[model samples]
Target: MTVRKVLIFGRFERFWHWSQMVLIIVLMFSGFGLHGFHALLDFELAVALHTYAALALLVLWLFSVFWLFTTETWRHFLPTGRGLWQVLRFYTYGIFRGERHPYRKAFWRKHNPLQALAYLMLKVVLFPLIWITGLLYLFYFLWRDLPHASDLLFAVAVVHTGAAFAILAFVFIHVYMLTTGHSFAEHVAPMMTGFDEVELTPEEEAYLEKDQPAMIR
Candidate 1:
């Protein structure tokens, strides 16, 4: 077995990735505690911490947007509905039978069709909905005297809470999938080192024997 060190993640990218992970986890714990999940942190303190963490995440996201545009990393996430069916087929049937991945990673593109779609929805739709509604709910008290503000606040709160749960569910699924790489920490190593190891299985080896290079360029 040979270990190769590849450049996977850059310094700022890794910093943002790990820092956001920590902040999100902290926010989740405090947010849930505020919802009466054993009261580890008092309601007031939880609210304060939640707000702080949310703001930090928002700033991190802004930095990420700038980074993506500057580095052209946004190209990696370009949604491709054309291969949606094939991606589903691979996940549902091909992988189970030890088939090769239909999608290949390149310098300009990192995600498969399914991954792009899911990530796009999560960022463009789900995250914005959560952020907007949460902000409105957070400042509801400041507008309590306005007409119909009460009803609007309640509605926004419901949406915010619902999105929060959905985000949590996505996190669980995302973490599990992260481990489905060349090895247990394969996907994880990329985030830490900025380079992912692309391996060829026995099936792929047959094709490589015909002179097709297996390593990703």
Candidate 2:
């Protein structure tokens, strides 16, 4: 078996990944403060910071959406459903017995079946819920002219808070999964350097070499 260092992640991908991670961390911190869960920051200060960070995240998401479509990198998140059960079993049971991964990374596909589905849901469902509810909560004043505005705002707040907690849970799981790579730094180093070392079978290597241009583009 031969291991090769491949440029799996591109420059923009690295930038977006790290930037989104930082923004999410800031949002989580400020969000908890606003929820009165802690006193790290004053209520007013926390509100201000949370709003700013959320807006910045929205902007980043917009640019990222455009980039994903233009580069067709969105294909990476498409669910193939193959080996989904095996992947889940590997994580839940097999990994404890030191079994190998059911799915391997490819030049065109970075995410496993479970990862692709989870990330797709995060982007299409969880994120939209939080963003839309946040907007309604933030601009309640403008919608106050409508009937039942107070109730609407309250519901939005409830959903937004719930989504925030869900995202926080996801963050914890994500951090833990980072250590599941070949080494502690194996998964993380690529995000910083845009390259990853992967072992490939002969057929896989041949396919990757032939499809390199399509993968990069």
Candidate 3:
């Protein structure tokens, strides 16, 4: 019960969060336009936009991966089963009954079990699939004359589109989850302000007080 206002996200983490969203959103819009699902942009323009945004996102992902591992923040995405069922149950049944969220926020584990699992899938599965298929699709010009090249290109496009849809679905679900918290702002304030009400051990409190006093309030 020793909750304190602690710095859970650093400056670069906040940049990664917001910039990744913008890049993905741009990719989605231009992608759908390229798919002929919309007429908002010209085909050539859509291609340029999508390609540039994808490249930017790729660079961001590379730096983010490095930062996460170097900062030991990657542990936050390691899924655990201990509270997974309770968190799932709360979302499915208890939440509608006005039950408070079952998980506590720890500075080391900002994401709950289910949230961590989702993020793990996105980072390891969905994102890789999207980028791989996208690169293959984009560089098709080099392989245009290869055997069954047309077929390969179509297959790549299908897989790339499917992965994009999966990411779009994730965005919808993430936004919906934001509202499930005490308040929408409560869920969002931590990332924006870099401070969150999280439980701290006595040792952690003492360490922050002595080594990084500004990180705690």
Count of clashes in candidate 1: 5
Per-model C-alpha lDDT, please? 0.76, 0.85, 0.94
Candidate 3 lDDT by residue in tens digits, 36-138 = 8999999989989999999999999999999999999999999799899999999999999999899998878998999999999999999999999999988
lDDT of 2 by residue, 1-217 (tens): 4566677788888888899999999999999888889998988889898999999999999999999999999999997778899989999999999988877776567788999988998999889999999988888889998998888888998999999988888888888888884776877888887777666667767766787743321
Worst 10 residues of 1 by lDDT: 1-10
Q: Candidate 1's residue-wise lDDT over 1-217, tens digit each? A: 2223334466888898899889879878988887676688978899899999988899999999899899887876788777788879988898888887677654345677888888888889888997888778777788889999889887887887788788899899888776553565766877876766434454544444455443323
Q: Largest lDDT belongs to which candidate?
A: 3
Estimate the TM-score of every prediction.
0.82, 0.90, 0.97
Shift of residue 180 alpha carbon in model 2, Å: 1.6
Rank list by lDDT: 3, 2, 1
Supply candidate 2's per-residue lDDT for 166. 88
Q: Can you tell me which runs of candidate 2 are displaced by over 4 Å?
A: 1-3, 199-217
